[model samples]
Target: MNKDFNSIVKVWEAAVRKSAGPKKRANRIFSTPMSVAHVDDDVYQVEKILNNGDFYTGQWLNNFPNGHGKYLWTDGCMYVGEWQKGNITGKGRFSWPSGATYEGDFKNGFMDGKGTYIGSNGDTYKGFWVMDMKNGQGTQSYPNGDFYDGDWKKGLQNGHGRYQWKNGNHYIGQFRNGLFNGNGTLMWQNGNRYDGCWEDGFPKGNGTFRWCDGSFYVGVWSKDSKEQSGTYYPSSGSDDDPLEWDPMDLFSVDLIDCYVCGCEKVSIFPSQKNLNMFGLEEDNNNKHLLSKKVTER
Candidate 1:
């Protein structure tokens, strides 16, 4: 951080705040900087340094950085791109000392419009931004092979989007505050799928689960599908009419983490009726659905 620059900014801000009335408050967090640089009479292309050891080299107007210019800060941050009226604006590339880089549209020093950000941890996001935050459509790729393609708001995963975990588990649904909080479909790599509503990163509300072996269940669920409550229909014959009209009490089977930071695995136990109907030997994957008792992974 540049202390000199910050002090100057603070002094300038104080002046603005005292000017504005109480009703019209000036957000100190967001600032509109005003400064004048002192240069020689010959104000041609030249390199000028500020009091804070920040330097700008390129087209300058009236002692301020204007038009195309490159600015380098004392903290090892450098920006090379367009400048307007002493502010970092327009298209440019900003690089930080932490190995993070942003290349795209900028507005008054804030990342706004289309751009791509490469984080220090190798995470990359390409999308639209508003006031330095990720907004609108974008695609984010994680170093661990996790990927997200969807809508974003205030730098969080919001609205509709698709998240693909590194374990081959993918979810497509609506999100709120970076979690699976709305309707979506989670498809496990093992061919297990759940289509329903989600809340706070877990499965909740009414939904349908389809197993790989043709078994399925329809019911309301809460949190993860640990012990789900609903009706289970084992895959005996047709999808329409179940060969056995028996409803088994579904209990703890698998723990599908929907696992943001962890992994999800769900297993269904064979009901006594399913065992008798299809015979355990014949139907290897014979399990059914409903009532849930969520447990930690």
Candidate 2:
């Protein structure tokens, strides 16, 4: 009983109007004649009684629209769906005057469960909803040919998903509050690829940058820029010595030499050829000397 009945009515009225069409057109209520007949205890049927000479003939309970009903509001707003104690519930389809439409499951007068919402601006979202907000897995497509398909929480991309732009740039990975965060992979239309950890939509921490020319860099990054020195591997090396490889390169290996250690032959142990490849001569088990520039290419 602490809930304000007047406020609740106003909110419900607003929800209907907003979902129908332009807010300015629905600001005022239109008068109409209506009749009500009692069916049983606290149950009745209303006819010809709605805003703006609209029609509503349906079952009512507790003096409110309940059970199955059809309500055509003023300003061409129409809703045909199930109701529970005056609130839209279950399956329904609501159409606005501007050609916007929503068809899906509802609960407590709010869009919940699976549904599709097509906006007048040519944007569309088809996914799980909660309280009229995108809340779960869904796909949103923009008018500009860009689209996002992934997990959502409270209308924001808050989990793993993929977004592709019209220009051919795309990102796939974890997200937090609609921004790229944690691990992800981004690919440019020009054939550049970045695989690494991200923070605030920029590549950060350890990552790899593979250029279109076959040269690649593996190392730490700060705000998407290479920090300090990193290991560079040329696609075509003429050096007779074995090339140095990053530990992460083995992650994409399809075969491994050892079952117990899961280490591939190229990464498990470095040979004397490997030491000479990096211009390094081992001084001890943990250190070495740089004999020359290993990456002259």
Candidate 3:
């Protein structure tokens, strides 16, 4: 068995030597060296040879995958699209050995364009890709039927988006690092709902929280705690007196002591007269008093 294996290896080496000249052999065996444009303008011909991974031939300006054309790694990863010098340029598609595929624009071999990525695990993402990850506006669907549609950054849920769970729970709002943050609305399967600001996946700031039992609170909140400010009226409260009132009337004042001496001598004043009964001098003050007779009854 060892002899047969050695024989096969020898034949393989001989075939490679015959197909590639000195420079080409040096390029494939020692290091990557070739440019597709230098060899031929036919992209299909270049792809055919490169796809085999036996011998790679291209414009050897700077050696390796630096040039305009298709490039395929021996590990079953392949790139088909534009190339500059040796790095991937313009639009392209990369298919990995693991069955993952990315089709979009490329910058130096990194995915950086509007494209779609289908993962080996059955997850799929369609949108803008940056540096080989999901970024910017996009949509992601999981194998379990969960999905998110919105803005993404570095593979995490960020900015405005909508998340739908398999069990019918849904959230529409802002997100940071896959957690609910900023302003948003959550609707549960049991009729409970929350519409307000969120922090680290918890309710915070000013907003309304509604329960399944028809109870609700509309007020300022701090990490889910209600603050001193806010209006929290029971659902069954009467709407006729919507204005809140306090039992203690702060504006009420007590009357001063009477100036009259006798019980029967009740002091009366004209409505139109502006005389200061208490502070007036002589005639004006005594006129009303003198008209009344002192009586015990």
Candidate 4:
């Protein structure tokens, strides 16, 4: 009978211990709330007060903003957007007190992917960016009404593009290092146009220049000057007939006073009218109009 009573006591003690253990655990859990600090009186939201005095208010994971949040720097700079592990990693807008701002994709707090940046001086850029520099295809607009749209590399104009100036001048062609370096066309405000090869922003090779007066020149150029051989086409209905003359050609001449311009270098083939008036006749092929020792009063 005593052995049976000791066995009963052991069963009762086991039951009591089981009941008390769960009750103590329940009390402890209820008394001590979750360790996560609420952001603004809401237990669901979390905030991280940075050591550098920068304030962040948003969802938090392990004391760092992990979800969408806004961070305000101590120097009046602010960024409001998605964050991953305390780094700006997604779409966000960062602004400065100096009126400079950037709004676009961010990778590790650096401007990456498509974005737009507006400078403090009213300059603006919109397009692909890499490491905060203009790269790939993009468009830049200056405050003075100048605009550029084309390929860029390392912040310099490269590849094909179009640049328009505020003075109604424009260029469309291949570019390298921010200068016209290949075939392109330039139009001026005065109705003049140049279409041809370019180097260092000037016509350098074979090309055509059309003037506002309807005259045109087609030939080769060197350092922006017509060189060697070129053809000049005058305007329609012009009284001046087609003349083939080489400016570099040498001619034989005697010292005589020109009745016209009084210049030492006189035109070789004066018109037939001038020849008749001067009483000069062609000796052979009529190539030389001025006779030997002939003077005009």
Better of 3 and 4 by TM-score: 4
Model-by-model lDDT, in order?
A: 0.62, 0.61, 0.53, 0.58
TM-score of 2: 0.63
TM-score of each: 0.66, 0.63, 0.57, 0.63
Error of 1 at 285 (Å): 92
Tens digit of per-residue lDDT, candidate 3, span 44-72: 12212322344332333332343444444
lDDT at 63, model 1: 35
Lowest summed lDDT across 10 adjacent residues in model 1 is found at 270-279
Q: Against the correct fold, how does model 4 do in TM-score?
A: 0.63
Instruction: Give the count of colliding residue pairs in each prediction.
Output: 13, 0, 10, 0
lDDT of 2 by residue, 1-297 (tens): 224734654454555565543223222222323344567886665554334334455676754567777765544566778877656778888766566778899876667899988877777889999877789899988777778899999878889999887777788899887777899887777776778887766657888877677777787766323353357677665343334444334332311210111101111100111111112122454342212233311
lDDT of 3: 0.53
Error of 2 at 6 (Å): 32
Model 2 clash pairs are none
Which portions of model 2 show Cα errors greater than 4 Å? 1-45, 51-55, 224-229, 237-297
What's the lDDT for residue 184 in model 3? 92
lDDT of 1: 0.62
